[model samples]
Target: MTTTRHPDARPSVSDPTGPPGAGRRVVAELLDLALLALPLTVGALLVDTLADADGGGQTDRVVFGGTAVLIALGILVWNRGHREGHTGASLGKHWTGLITRDRDTGHPVGTRRALLRRGTDVVTTRTAAHDHFTPLPPDTGVAALRRRRLLGLAALTVLLMLVLLASVAVGARPMSFAEVYHALIVNDGAETDIIVHSLRIPRTLLALLVGIALGVAGALIQGHTRNPLADAGLLGINAGAAFLVVLSIYLFGLSTPAQYLWFAFAGALTASVVVFGFASIGGGKSNPLSLALAGAAVAFFLQAMTQTIVLLDQTSLDGYRFWVVGSVAGRGMEVLWQVLPFLLAGTVVALASTPALNVLSLGEDVARSLGTNIVATRVVGIAALTVLTGAATAACGPIAFVGLIVPHIARAVTGPDYRWLVPYAGLLGGVLLVLADVVGRIVVRPGELQVGIVLALIGAPFFIALVRRRKLVSL
Candidate 1:
């Protein structure tokens, strides 16, 4: 008989012909579980402390405890899928020098298979541990990916310019291309010039700014957490802004967009800080699982409070409804001016962090080995996300799905590189929002739908298609 040794083989006395024994697997899992639990424990303590400081009763403590537990479970779920899916190695497995591979092909498994394996292990606890797998094709080279990204950016830029023109041209009042050009260039004193300068131009600019901010924010949130489903709306940012806008209307009778803009911005910033703080309890670094769970918990809590207040007062609801629906209309250059600095700063931060994000995506161990400062990267990323999301929400009343959908579309075109993804996402986001605004204007004629409503209509179907196709987790 002849024996062959693989290049990466490690000898095991107990399992001479196979993988690691069940005992080793269990021990590795226990270690990983302990590591995962550390942050949850810290989060629980912090939540308890905050509750006590706020003079919260037993009920509040219980609520916080329950939320902490839910977050822990969410973290477990996220970790199981993410750690095993991407590298075929959980933190414990990696530490134990045990790597999972396809049983049939003896190759690394993709994210879907890893998730399935974890799911099966949960459901059929006593079943024989076996897996069947197929090998993945070779990866595309970096140069090829870059070329594709460049092409995508070029295409998206063209689309965005067309949409910007359309946004300026098609509105409650229509104007010809010639009139639009003349108004923009010649500064003619015609009715076209008044509409273009006074109404369409400002709103269009606002749309572009809001779109860029939301898109980049969404990308940052998703990349930082390594969660494909992450979005500003899902993370309580939009709900937070909505809650404050509602509060301002009910308490202070703030009617104009300008009056509630600062309130909305403050609310957004607060929500982000709370979410980050909760996620960073023990580790000081934001884990993907913690971020998602914290965001969800905050979002649900704020949304409930907002709904309760709106239901209690009809006048507040009437005012809140408009803001909650999220439109770029009725905004002028002043609104743009107010948010431009924050948005610009956020955008610059996002672009600057792309390289760090790229490194961070390669798992913490790899990132650390490559000399990446994981904590600093996460802090910068979160700051960018907060500023961008807050500015956009303040300006546009929390437009949905621009952040969620645009990045996915950009990713499909640009692959997983953040350098290309950020710019592409920003451009695509502007295009999508402006296009949605134009469609909303046209579909209802003089009675236009808000951009948020239009996006929900468009984004829902696209999201459904993405899930059905199982492409949502491509990142």
Candidate 2:
């Protein structure tokens, strides 16, 4: 934890400076996100628009096939984002006009330190449509950054409101902005008000909340462990959760989403405990790779147990599909609300660890000298990570690549400050997931694909790029 931050820190004022290559990377990231969104968005709208009320066969093909396509596109972008984000934010930083200057030293950002900037940008500057990020004149570098960050934040806020408000206006059924606004303000259910209240508004809010929560959790876990390759399922949380669900179904005969959810959460927590116990073993303690391997081993063992239990009777498989596939469909606002306490508490815990994380990046000896309690931080971080990821996995069935990927992107955008990184990662994750979910809705003509599949498709290439970069760039 050799890193340091300025509480009074402010963005630099300038014309969002960057290296020559930064523009290309920014364009690439934008293109990737857009490409993934485009096909899925169009496909969903197309399928929903064209599908027969009777759910025709042709519509099914279009929706399902499109969903597959959407997944592939999402993967492409996600993979690219990870690569670009992690490789020192190269072209993306330059082009985005965001610079990752060191916080304590007040100089250009070092490799790991860059994540801090991204975190701040993602969280405060990039989240929700707020007027917070007001740009200063370009003559001052810090002022400019602050302004850009603020602008970025404000722009994002407006963009999000517009996108969601627009969706409410024009979804399975369409509404004008005025009409939707009127419904909201009046709080009355006119013919139009019913559609506004029931379908688009709730779903839109749900999307934002889910996306933010998932994205933040993903970032937190990846950064906490410093493993770009790790996913929520890395430690077999899903397998464990699934086993519990299987038990609930075959032995207990409880198949409802609400009933099974608790069992799954319990299983996830149990798996996390086991995984961490193994990781904390040995003389020095487990690093990223060691922890991942341990998780994978635990997951495999649990999955075997689940399979064995299910073999006794075929009745358990029915509950497995819907839970295992990881969907945002058919869930109520209450479920979202129920999981939020865990999410909020976990988020706070994770955010509190940022400063220590920065110091740890400098090497253990340095971090220790700088007054960091490596042991305490690790234990707390793990606990927080376990809860956040486990809750998300248990609630949503192991959404993939997010924890692994979003932090990389966050790192690229901001810098290595965990403070900035956590929020940015979370916001980015939210945006990405919500958008992906939307795409899944339209891609298959009428059928939908799972976000997990889409993230995998997008992330596999990114995983390759990460390996390649780590191979090429040593520390």
Candidate 3:
């Protein structure tokens, strides 16, 4: 007797490649296990080095080592056990062309069934593998997700306001909240008013503007370069600014931030132009890799010139050291006013370019396919980046890590969408720098640490933890 089946019905059983061999299974499992172990081992070694540097005791070592081990185990369980059980393929299995599927239906056994199958395999000393696969569920709720991000941005804004208040209130001569409020709103000409209005207010405002500039510039640079680690420095902004500042000090005897601001701005702008020009030379098309390489070369050359100037002239060295240390202190509102136009222009352009950036993130081929003007997008991005970085560096020196760290933090909350990412980064950058400035004040008491130094101390460990916590977000 012949079996009858409906034309619309599909095959219930399908196995394109049949079961993978025992050798393949064993190799895949070993590969997966090794992959899981590698990060933990690296993290422990790094922690050990840091501990040794800090002169940590045995207990510290034990605690850190144990934490690393536990984190590793958690990852192992997620990657090898839960993720693989749910998805039917670990990294090893995927690499080795193996998958686990139900015997009857030729589909990935749901997580529990897959775990049960593994248990059965262990008991029977047998292997189960197939080539069947299913696509993951489509992403939805984008509107809700965006709304959540908006709320997060608002929360960050509020936090930044508190930090601003703290920056104003927590200086050498600490003032109460009431004093700070009165100083700002009611000018009674008191000592608190003098301190608040004259010193702390200017410094805080400078920090806020500079932080926003650096942060937004950083996000734009990273977006353009497609490098999460990239920042304004990649375009030689810092080096060029330093070079010109040094020159101005050596040649013109300019000693103050205000005196040297124009030189620094010019140098930063020139360096970025040079970078873009060099990147666009051969094919008239600038890619991320080319831009990065060009920027590095220009930066090195400028830095060499800067160092030579500083070494030759004592005055230059002193001035350069002060500028290079990166601080918002000792800057007046006049300095902020000087950079305000460039900063505003850069910010507007940066925001305008966000839509293009989103398209470009899809890679060049795809971007071109979708009618994105790659060169134009890059030019806008670089222009915005240069202007913002130039203005900020000129105003407050190149405050390290504000640019580098803020974008990543913002991205964590805002995802890869540049529209949200840029604004979030700007606000977060302001918050972080101002907060770091406050911490610097408190940590050293009478004499405060530079914002740059504080950022380095805080940023280093935070960055390490960020890396160890999970994979960097894809640019």
Candidate 4:
């Protein structure tokens, strides 16, 4: 028997065996990486420009440039709407030529169709999700799936965009719509640039990256575990990373944020393994609910231990508070680089599992008959999840809803196909966090809400709704 796959440049629904082409995926990723890296690179260049400069000039320049990029991203996102959602996106979609089109007529696409397409995509993706990792209601109606997906997408876009725009406007030196517009486009060295760079841009970008990582990681983990509730932080990776910092402070007396890296990485990896083992322990297959429970258990256990540690040592407590609460503030390029390798590697592995996840969705007997390597698939998925969650928690100190909420958002747009779901989730995730973080910056006038806090405040209701869901679906 010969194995076949989709061409990486363009994914064909008909072809399921080929690796996704690099060009489409890579270009978009590179663009995002550049966004993350550019701020610091520019800041460094500015510092170099004025070696004899005091902190004030360097600060102003760094802040200004960073803010410009943030505004660009926000405006870019706003303009990215094809009625809604990304089209010809990722590096590969450009090369392989992927475009969102009218589902039925299959024409060049208009805003209404794009919106409808997004609506369907989310339904298909989420409904399929119901069947794959966790079971939806017995004989869950197609119509229900469609509605959920549409509602999810609508909720996300409305919330994310409003928050982002408001955040941009809300700042220490508040600017009217005109000034903000001038800073974003004209870019004549003014206080407007400072507003754009220092607060709005960098924070938004950081939130974007963090959200993307978390959203993709959530999809991977959820798809892998088959548990709708499974989140990157829920799996104990967040606590592990935080605990590592706690350990470092308690033992080594480490102080700088830079010093938190190794410990965070170590913590993330360790937690993943422990959680995996817990999920897989029973003789039966590791269901999504079991995995989620395992993760929740581990997370609570670690958090309790951490709180105890904090209660004992104020120094450790001081270090842990900001990180545990989850914020995108004060995160510079250094933090981005330090955790980037893990995020990239993890995302690759997760993306790699989409085919297997698709097969798994067909159920165990079918998967085995088709030679899907269920055990191996599980291993790869778990590993991918570990790497992704580890890196994300390490980077952003356990930002939550991006992972939990973004997949649902992606599903609303792309449907339940893991193939499209994974990538779109990443984009939607980026958009979500950027909006959230941006809002955090502006909501309370300069003091900032902190991305984590904002998400929790928002995510709390969603999470509660999920928990309150009366119908428990079993596959």
Candidate 5:
């Protein structure tokens, strides 16, 4: 007897070709488990160190440990959702050449269905066969996705502008929106005008510039390295700058940001080159794992050196501590002026490198086949990354996670295209930093939380949520 089949029907599960075997999958899961535990481990270590130094009571330890545990649980759940939900691949999966896709359509299972699939998989874990497929809806086509992205971006843009305006209006000395507008336009001999011109406007502009720089730099770094966790700080840029800034203070008594700007820039560039050089040493071409490991090693070394220098000199430590925590406050037009040209140059380079990045995303062989100059493209990207991250770190003392978190947010809205990703990242980053700065001011009352501290507080949960909500392993 002959079997009949419909032309449109496809198998619910394909022949497991290229699917990671159980052992490989287990290894990948272990790797992901390690990554998930990393933050909690670091937090615990930090708490222990601080407690030991301060001779803290058990109450302090208990509170800190409890908080850390809650945060860790949230992160774990969110990451699990993201890995199993969106792309059906976690960090380990990406490294191991595993993918979760609809067996029939061969498309990603997507976030919602993926969550359902995960739930079912957890329940049926005792069974022999753990293989499962979540069907995807019919393709909506590229144009539809683009349209949705555009709409989302436009909304975010509007929201960002509102946040900017609010940043301009709210501070230690609050002003009405009308007052802010009046001060900007009129500039009479009023106190508000002085505050607006001399303090608020410059700070807000600096925030915008720094945000754009870090955001673009992050997108470039992630694209070039193909690592979701890659950031300027991770590459030792921040540690390098901080070390040089401390050295300048220790040696030459350079106190102001403007005085140490060049030192920071030079250090950042030098560190980036060293990291890349080390990563490239054994390579046919430096893969993401090599780059990430090299960066981590360099960052740790530089940070250790900086700590030693600071510990040896009390005066230098006092001066360096503030900058290390990262803030845009107290920065004037001079520091902004110093970093502006470099930031502009980096932005231009980043934008121009977008096409190359898009091609490179398709894998090196494919990019070369399509006539891409892979070497030149990487060089340009690294140059841009150095300049952008270096300038931003120089200006703002290494504000954490703007580079790491903003790009992921932008990517969610804009999809994988670098052209849209770059701009969206820039705009959203500006919003995030400015908003964070504003929150920092308000949260601690008359005294302010440093923007960096506030960002870490906010970004940690968001990062966990993002990991839970999206599939981060794909190109």
Candidate 6:
């Protein structure tokens, strides 16, 4: 039982028992197949859930579907991609104490190599007898990781508060701290009172909600799809919502955000269903690739339809252009109240799903073996994602980048753990959005850029840098 040591990394444990027997390998492969089939089984159930629901249960449907999608995908990626790449073992391999190692250096195979080997090994069972295996690392750094994540969350919360203060204090019309305080507590009906109470407060609150929603939504999207580049829009929520808003303007002469809010929400929820349905078309299973492709196609089609309508109707064109710019400005408490329930529901579901997500990220077989309900967990994930993204998009017209970029920032701090990543992303998102809105107000005094535009301006450069700096991996 000689251990092969690596100076640069963890050493591999040698087994005098030689390689795993053919029966073990066969069982492992079968387990892997079951894991792969889990998604399809869940997708089939999801379709049934959708078909049986009534119109009144639209929100419920969206919530369940989105939540389940994320959980399902998270499990798939963790089991198949991250687990094998980072540790040198898949679920089956872990069970059988099998591992892929460098043929030359006798080192653990990295992600790229692990993935390549997965394909080759499937075709041919032949493995070198010299191959060594290691069990999953113990939960050594968990406490440290939890402590760090908690600290990061606290820091983000504080930053969010500061940004909220800035959002309230600094706007097109600057109010001194005392004046702002007076407006809230005193309410003497002065100019500052009207500005603070009527304008900045609601706008700031809306931004806060939108930020948290987009941020968490982004994190969930990345987790579910296992795509580093995936964002809230990957599910077609934004485009679907925007398209309906425009359509409402064109056909019904709806001019206000409140008027179209429901329509947008409906569109978003509908789009999520459509994406899932399309993904589940073949063999009644929805994979991440199928979901992504379907989402993209649906989003593009909806956008094109929206454009055609906007171009044809002058009234719609005017209303659509402004609404599409994505601003929390001019929206009142009523708008916030309307979307608050969905946001709250989504947030709760998302947070609750994180523990299951953590388990799912380990692998389906492991999760099942540990008593995690694969179907229910995934349904909850997909549902949470739909509600969050739909509410955010409905509240503020498809703000880009917040969902696309905030998760990456959160992931960098929290590592691959979704438990911390989702909350951190939400807090960071609120801070960034409120901060961006404040910057927009100050930079162009007497006028302000919409929050959506500001986010795009900031997000585009930062995203480009993120891409240049690192590889995109779905945590």
Residue-wise C-alpha lDDT for candidate 4, range 170-206, written one tens digit per residue: 4555465677777778878798877676656665656
Report the C-alpha lDDT of model 3 over 10-76, residue by residue, as the tens digit. Answer: 5354523333568888888799778767767866774555343444334334434554676677666
Best by lDDT: 3
- RMSD after CA superposition, every candidate: 18.5, 14.3, 10.6, 17.9, 12.3, 18.4
Candidate 5's TM-score reads 0.70
Best candidate per TM-score, number? 3
- The TM-scores of all predictions, comma-separated, are 0.69, 0.67, 0.71, 0.62, 0.70, 0.69
- lDDT for predicted candidate 3 compared with the true structure: 0.80
Cα deviation of 208 in candidate 5 (Å)? 0.6
Model 6, 1-475: lDDT tens per residue? Answer: 8966355653335434344568877887778768867765765464354443222123223433444565566666767666776666678876776665555655555566665664324211224333444424634487877887888888677667766766776665544557767987999899989988888899999999889988998888887777788897888888899899989998899999999999999999999999988988976767678889999999999999999998899999999888888888889999999999999999999998999888877777898899998767766788898999898888878888998888888887788788888998899888888878876774454577888888888999988887886555545
Better of 3 and 6 by TM-score: 3
Better of 3 and 5 by lDDT: 3
Of the two candidates 1 and 5, the one with more favorable TM-score, higher being better, is: 5
Worst 10 residues of 1 by lDDT: 119-128
Cand. 2 TM to true fold:
0.67
Per residue, candidate 2 scores C-alpha lDDT tens digits across 385-452 of: 76776667666776776776777776665556677777777777766666666556544534667766
Q: Write the per-residue lDDT of candidate 5 for residues 1-475, one digit (tens) a residue.
A: 8986566665345423223457877876788788767767866864574353444334334434554676676565555555555545656656765565554544455566654553223211111123543433434689888887788788778777766766776666655556777897988869988998898889899998998899999999999989887888767888889889999889999888888889999999999988888877865456667778888899899889989999999878987987888899999999999999999999999999999999999999999999998878987898898999999999989888898898888887777899999989988888888888876765554577889999999889977876786666576
Q: How close is candidate 6 to the true structure, as a TM-score?
A: 0.69
Give candidate 2 regions above 4 Å deviation.
1-148, 166-183, 190-203, 464-475
* Model 5: worst 10 consecutive residues (lDDT sum): 119-128
lDDT of 6: 0.77
